[model samples]
Target chain A: MTPAEDYELPAGPGRNDNWQGVTPRQAFMRGMAVALTVPGIILFASAAGYGALARDAGFSLGNSVFMMGVFFALPAQVVLLDQIARGGSLMAGTLAVTLTGMRLLPMSVLLMPLLKGKRATRWRYLVAGHFIAVTAWMEGWRRLPLVPSELRMDHFIGIGTGLVLATLAGTWAGFELAGSVPHVVEAVLLLLTPIYFLLSLIASASGEADRLAIVLGGFLGPPLYVAFPGFDLLLAGIIGGSIARFVVRSRGTG
Target chain B: MTSSLHEVTQAAGAASGTLPTGLTLALILTVISLATHEPWRWLGLILGRNIDVDSELFRWVRAVSTALVAALVTRLVVFPAGALGGVPLLVRVLAMLCGLGVYLLFGRRISFGVVTAAVVLVAGQSIMGP
Candidate 1:
């Protein structure tokens, strides 16, 4: 997507809000800058867990890194590993991965408004939409509101692009070290991912609906897995979210 | 679940170790996964065109995504496989709770929660001595 023009912010102090002089190039760099911080380190660590798992699952180091690089979404990649482990057919694996990938749609939908300025094209959004990594999307939601419109797309691309290194590098490192490390150490690393995901969800959750969804989904997920197996994640999410929404709406109406 | 599928996997497994890098299953997997994942982004371009960002429908969809992630994260904690499966179930559950407890107690300081959880998780395994 081509940058048409810049939207300058009124002078401010809390953030570097002077957008008048910042080019899309500069904003893109800023996005990269933000992603390479503590959050980036956390992402790298989480991805390292993925690396260890992938190697243990019998994926080649090259393949694991390649998956991390291309998929960029951690959970979907894990689903692929799950499929392989089950000796699932390719069609089954594709369906499961696609269901997981559906989460990206809402993520992109929420981001669209933030990425818009005067006369922005669908191409820009299409580009911005691809960088829909969970952390990237969450970080974008948290950070992009402050950004002037034209630069949001570039900045998001930068954030997503920069995080790619940490993920790929982490995956590579994990795969290479999988067997060399003590079993205990590898186990601990693998354990970090679920804990990290849980904590991040708790930390980032906002308002009643998110809280409700988290609670309901937590209750629903394991039981659904027993009954539905591969359909657990999708069913849990949809059912939990719908119930939460319905309850919230009913409360509002009453 | 079927014999043909089993045969396919057996064949693929047999070939995986020795296959040339150019034609490895990994390369094919990357292509297939990428192909499946790509259409959703484009689908976003289409759906995002008319959607109002703050509408209830939008929020509900967002809720669905968050719930899905929650389900996924918890499933890993609950029904773990692979390396994590080695850790006892009690250890995993406690690790999650301890992390969550500290995270909530510390005004949502993520690093504090993670570090606390990591300590519990690793320690739980050592204490279990398996």
Candidate 2:
């Protein structure tokens, strides 16, 4: 088995006891601290950019900030804003945003198992589902394998909550700073979000298949977007992913 | 739904002289997104309980999502939007390289790369005066 495969196996007796002294709350707090390092900064930058964009588009500050909380998916939120700014119909805006968010469905499904706990309530699952954006999902997937199952939920929640709160704060900051900040600085701040997501996604990629998918998608997206415009995202994902999967499986590397 | 939101935004615009387009629609979209996400997990619970977490299908889903995100990121970088469109292409590509370099050199920590990219962009733009 690959090193990555070995990493996913549950720790044996003494290994699991490494966290013996750490309380669940402590574990949760530690997770939050780690989250604030990378994911929080990314989310903050992205949300700040989104806020600035919304402000430029004439969205009320309240609405902009509220959107951060309501539609935690940054891409979908941006799509909603873009559609609205273009004077698209409400249904068109809603459908576009919803379709953009369809990617989150699989993420939510993948996360559900990692979050299993003896005492986990249905409500916890429901609420946690809302927070399962790319950041939370990627972070949780990386960290949860070694975490004791009991503390998994706490860790996930801690990271997720930190990201959510950071997004909120960033949105407000971006909105308020849009006017006073130099255009260069504002643009750089906006760039941070996508850069962070791309790097994290690539850096934490599991194996060759994922790497291949990233390459294919990166190359294919621009031309596809120019050709199909609205459908580029979905088509590139499905096509690139399938091609990557086939390559990996055919090579017998997976 | 479209007509109602149009009327609402139009009425609000007429009163305030500013478009409050899709406020209600945004709310509706959020509700729909949240509501739609739940059923997938429930389906997973019913069907995926016995299946391996990293099953082939799960891998495919992850791959597809990752590809989608990659595509979106690429689009944002290449085509850009709004103010970003004004920045020179070379600076953007160079900033991305600087960030990627930092990401690899700094034990693959994400913050280092992300911060490096942002700093590079700001510094590059300031120096170039564009």
Per-candidate DockQ values are 0.38, 0.32
Model 1 CAPRI rating: acceptable
Query: With candidate 2 superimposed using the best TM-score fit, by how many Å does residue B124's alpha carbon deviate from the native?
Result: 2.2
User: Which digits, one per residue and each the tens of the lDDT, describe model 2 over residues A1-254?
Assistant: 01122222233455433666677787678667754564567678878888877776667788888888877778777656644554445464555454445556555656777888864677767667667776777767777777888888777777778788889999999888876887787678667656876786675477888889888988888898778755676778889888998899899898
| TM-score, A chain, model 1 | 0.77
The alpha-carbon lDDT assigned to residue A217 of candidate 2 equals: 83
Per-residue lDDT of model 2, residues B47-101, tens digit only: 4346454668867876776677788777767766555655677778788889989
User: Candidate 2, which segments miss by more than 4 Å at Cα?
Assistant: A1-38, A83-114, A138-155, B1-22, B35-48, B51-58
Candidate 2 docking classification: acceptable
For every model shown, what is its TM-score relative to the native structure? Answer: 0.78, 0.76
Clashes of each: 0, 0
Q: After superposition, how far is residue A203 of candidate 2 from its true place, in Å?
A: 3.0
What is the DockQ score, from 0 to 1, of model 1? 0.38
Give the alpha carbon lDDT tens digit for every residue of B3-52 in model 1.
Answer: 22224335556755322233466676777666878677667667775755
Candidate 1 lDDT for residue B22:
33
